[model samples]
Target: MHQVYVLKRPHVDEFLRRMGELFECVLFTASLSKYADPVADLLDKWGAFRARLFRESCVFHRGNYVKDLSRLGRDMNKLVIVDNSPASYIFHPDNAVPIASWFDDMSDRELLDLLPFFERLSKEDDIYTMLQEHKSS
Candidate 1:
């Protein structure tokens, strides 16, 4: 149950960085088609730092919406998709929990609260344990 955090905005980086301090992070950055060479150059420079932060991280340069979304959901069932707008378009179908936060309005404490559930799902045996607990209750 490796938790994959899909970050969609530039401003969300700060919050993502804070989360990385506590969890194993796999960051998904939007494509750089609009920015072209400049964006590519920046990613090349930033690649090293991104690599060091996680067990693995990748840049999705192709904005194949349907394909990427399908892959993301398949890769990890336990995901926290963070976005600045209503993510109902994406999360509604997958049953993923979306956390909406504006750059100026978001708080670190609020993000930290979700860590426990994310960590629990990342464990292989937690599903059965959770079911057992649920049945007993």
Candidate 2:
């Protein structure tokens, strides 16, 4: 099964920059129409790295909490939800492991702090190996 990584809120860019290095990242933006113009303007100013990543990514929009959870249910065991919120707050009663941010304000250094957690999760889940097998067969 393909491991699903759901990124929430402002962590979209950070998630893209970081996870893109190790995993195929699927970014769930709230609504492209809602912020398309502004986001585009920002992208023009900020540069196209994120835009490139966004283009070569899976985007899930127009979803509610229940809908998101249901989509995640298809591969709950292989899903890892990353957000800036506390893990306790983001974790549902259902099976979900959240990769919580370890800092008040997210930054490169702060994201680096999550490397250990990411390595641990990736090791435990064997997502890369599983994905390779699935792809090969």
Best by lDDT: 2
Please write out the lDDT profile of model 2 over residues 30-120, one tens digit for every residue: 3433344345444333232332222113223333322143343345556554434332224332333334444344343544555555555
Kindly report which residue stretches of model 1 are placed more than 4 angstroms away from their true locations once superposed.
Answer: 1-24, 31-67, 72-80, 84-92, 106-108, 124-137
**Cα deviation of 2 in candidate 2 (Å)?**
37
Question: Top model by TM-score, which number?
Answer: 2
**Could you estimate the TM-score for every candidate?**
0.39, 0.42
Error of 1 at 129 (Å): 12
Model 1: how far residue 95 lies from native, Å: 4.8
lDDT (C-alpha) at residue 125 in model 1? 38
After superposition on all CA atoms, how large is the RMSD of candidate 2? 11.6
Residue pairs clashing in model 1 are: 1-122
Worst 10 residues of 2 by lDDT: 50-59
Any idea how many clashes model 2 has?
0
Spell out the clash pairs found in candidate 2.
none
